[model samples]
Target: MSIRFAIVGCGRISERHAQHISNVGELVAVCDIVREKAEGLAEKYGAKAYTDLDEMLRYEKEVEVVAICSPNGLHAAQTIAALQAEKHVICEKPMAINPYDCGEMIKAAERANRRLFVVKQNRFNPPVAAVKELIDAGKLGQIYSVHLSCYWNRHNAYYANSWKGTKALDGGTLYTQFSHFIDLLYWMFGDVKEVTAYTANYHHQGIIEFEDTGVVNLRFYNGTLGSVHYTVNSYQKNMEGSLTIFGEKGTVKIGGQYLNELEYQQIEGIEIKDLPPGNPPNQYGNYVGSMSNHDHVYANLVQVLTNNGIIATNGFEGLKTVEIIDKIYTAAKPL
Candidate 1:
């Protein structure tokens, strides 16, 4: 029997989650503040619809999993509610807007004896996976430094009258646009030990409450140094999202706009070749987000829930992502 699932937020990203859930599990319910959005996904997936998440959680007792695709700020409350109701949670990235909320979500899940999964789907990208394997195998040796670049264009219309640009809901550009990249940084290197950043609104001054562009320096717990350059003001479209690693033994770069391609690699007698093709980046009308790996995410969910397999990304890892972002934001200085 497939695991029964319910989705809380019926936004663009929710559609992707629902699609994957439908493939691996049964989408039993969908909820959104906008009844129309909830009803729309419900109609397509043959699921029930409700405006209130609690109502749906109460009514849909068959829902073994709750996928939280709501805004960054709403994630903690919604996830805790679902966990308290005895359901595992699969939260979209950044976990929560802040680390305290993330800790609370984990505590709730622990109290309820349920699982909490965070969407760090980008880690499943073939090039990313290959690099991780190499690093773990000491192919990269003692890492010295790294660079992360996120240049994506959100434009005015993308944020217009939506939660995309708000400080309360969106939780800054790192949370919404580049947290996955940040997650990659933490996953490969260890935790960030220090951060110094300068940020600016740049093009979206009157549009977004927080900075649209930032230059950040990081020192990892292992004493590895790094820099992150991110912006949503790229001309016309997303230009690139890349991570370059420099280490004692080798250098490798996972480049391309979505970090889908292994742009360069010169290991000490190792090369990444013949990687299985990965899913394309998620296209949301004019803009594109990270690589589409929700399918892998749901598959892992099923494996863990049904077969006692290992979880790809757990709640603690999720909390670390939020913690790192919190550190960066706290350390940011206006440009």
Candidate 2:
């Protein structure tokens, strides 16, 4: 049985979700405030389009899944509405601006007895998956600290054209881009006990209220300390995202785009030695770095729903990510 999907907010990322739904499941409907954008996606996928989500839900009874791709701030409300309508939801990252909204959304899903998945698709990367497998197998025993870094160049014009630059809409670099890495941090490590962060708008001078550069210090529940360093300023446009985990038996370093580089060293007796090489793809050619590979995650989600398995990034996971972001932002605020 194919899962019918209705996509809300036909923005830039909605195109990727539409493509995936058309390829993997039934693309039942598309909705957006802008009629043209919604209709455009509907036409491409042979699905109906609506300017209003309520109308779409009422008419498209086959839409069992709702994909919320709206602005960061609108995610919680839209997700709760979708769940109340008895539809499973797949919300975009930065689940909500704050933990309260996230909790409300989760409560709605629980009340409706529906599944709510969050788009932390970065974890689906091949290299990242491999590292996770190793960690699960206890190759890197008794994990210690982690260092995560994301440095990408986003010009002022990029934020100027969309609702991305404002705190009221897109949140910030922490919400917009680094949210994935932040979730990955929790996914691999667990809830953070405490966070201290500093954020500033040193670059990308504009009329925006969010910062382009920020640093966060994290103390995990297991007594593992970590640091996240992020910035949206670079001269030649490059992406550097890496996670290094230290353990008692061995230490693992996964670097490069999407954590595509992996190196493991075992502390055997006298000194440490590097393990055999893991698959590391070239940095330049992966066109659809993280966002474009929605098909893989979507397929897994469909199977989970069909087989009565648990959704990978469910509403609780979404809320946890939001809570971490809320704490980080709260700490980063002016003192």
Candidate 3:
């Protein structure tokens, strides 16, 4: 049976979701406040376009799934409404502005008895998958510390159009770009016990009230300490998502997306001797290096719905991520 999908908020990323739904499930409806955006996507996907979600839900009876691609602030309310309407939900990242909203979304899903999946598509990258496998295989040994460096460049104009630069709306870099690293951190090292963070809008001289640079220190529940250095200012414009894990027996470094390339050093038996570092400037050489084909996440969502498999990033996971972000934001605020 084909799942019928309706997408809310026809924006930049919604196109990717639409392509996936068209390929896998039946693209039944498209809804956006902007009529032209809805109509454009509706025509492309052969789905009805609506300006109001209630109208779409009432009229388009076949829409079993609703993808919440609206602004960051609207995600929780929209997701809860969709679940209440008896449609499963796939919410975009930074699940909500805060943990309370995320919890409300999860509650709505549970009450409605529908599945709620959060789009943490970065984890789907091939290199990241490979790193997970390596860690699971005990190649990294008893992991202790992790260093995540995400320094990308997002121009001031990027946040000029929408609710992006505002704290009440977009929630800043910790909510936007560095969120991938936050999710990655949780993926690698389970729960966080404590977090101390500092944030500032140092680089971009804009009216928007949010941070463009943030440094976070985390203490994991398992006694693993980690640091995340995130900034939106980079002169070279190179995107780097790298992780270096230090373990009791050995160390493993996976640089770039999907962690496709690896460098590992192991110290044999209780000698207490340090093994030489694997490589200088260990560049996984663009491991699995290339942009991901669009619709990758949507296709995966289809599989999850059809197979009744566990949602790798479910509503609970989304809420937890938001909780962590909230903690960081709180710590960063002035005392």
Candidate 4:
């Protein structure tokens, strides 16, 4: 039997969710403040449309899972409400803007006895999967340090007439632009023990409320040292999103425009080969970068819901992602 899904935000990301939901399950309803956007997606998928999420939740009794594709700041409230309505939730990344809200969302899920999954689709990238396996199996012995780079362009036009750059809605470059990279850092290493950072609005001064570029240093709980350099000031398009690790036994770099390529490796005796190509990056009007791995995400959701399988990204993991980002932003000082 197909899982029944409903969407609470019919934005660009919602299209990806709807497409994957249709493949793995049925899209029973869609909700958005903009009537046109809601109706547009609903009509395309043969699902009911609504301008209010609460009303949709109340009426769409068959919706087993609610995907929260709304703006960053609204994720916690929307997700908590859906969980209270006795439906599972699949929230987009960063989970929530702050750790407090993320904690509340987790509490709501526990109280309601519902599942809360966060979308960290980059984890499904074949190269990422391979590297994770290597690290887990101790190939990267005593992982000493790691470096992350996110050089992506988000022209002024991309933020115009949308909620992409605002502090209240978008929650800064890390939340909207590079949370996946941060999550990968945590997933591979462990919790961040310390953070020191500096940020600036080099190019997007009047456009975005927060920094457009930043540098960070992290000390993971497992004694791994990490550094991150990120920016939306890359010339005209996304330049690179990569992670390089150095350890006692091996060195590996996962580099590409996205984390889709296993660029370099010098393991002790293991070789990563025959990695199947991954899905193309998601495109929104003109900008592109969010890896299109929602199919894997939805598939995992189904496996966990129906087969008692392990959730690829659970609520606690989602909360940790936010907690790390919160620490980074809190440590950040203007450069």
lDDT of 1 by residue, 224-300 (tens): 99999999989999999999999999999999999999999888988789999999999999899999999999989
The TM-scores of all predictions, comma-separated, are: 0.99, 0.90, 0.87, 0.99
lDDT of 3 by residue, 73-92 (tens): 88988898899899989987
Off by over 4 Å in 3: 257-296, 333-335
Q: Candidate 3: which pairs clash? A: 126-258, 127-258, 127-259, 127-260, 128-258, 128-259
> Per-candidate RMSD vs. true structure?
0.7, 3.7, 5.8, 0.8
Backbone clashes (count) for model 3: 6
Query: lDDT: which is higher, 1 or 3?
Result: 1
In candidate 3, where is summed lDDT lowest over 10 consecutive residues? 279-288
80, model 4: CA deviation in Å? 0.5
Q: Which stretches of candidate 2 lie over 4 Å from their true place?
A: 263-291, 333-335
Q: For model 3, what is the C-alpha lDDT against the true structure? A: 0.75
Per-residue C-alpha lDDT of model 2 across residues 5-70, encoded as one tens digit per residue: 999999878887887787778898999999999889999999888999888888887789999999
**In each prediction, how many residue pairs overlap at the backbone (N, C-alpha, C within less than 3 A)?**
0, 0, 6, 0
Pairs in steric clash, model 4: none
Query: After TM-score superposition, what is the CA distance of residue 13 in candidate 1 from its true location, in Å?
Result: 0.8
Please report how far candidate 1 places residue 92 from its true position, in Å: 0.6
Per-residue lDDT, model 1, residue 182, is 95
Cα lDDT tens digits for candidate 4, 1-335: 78999999899999999998988899989999999999999999999999998899889888899999999989999999999999999999879999899999999999999999999999999999999999999988999999999989899999999889999999989999999999999899999999999999999888899999999999999999999999999999999999999999999999998888899999998899999989999988778876799999999999999999899999899888888988999999997
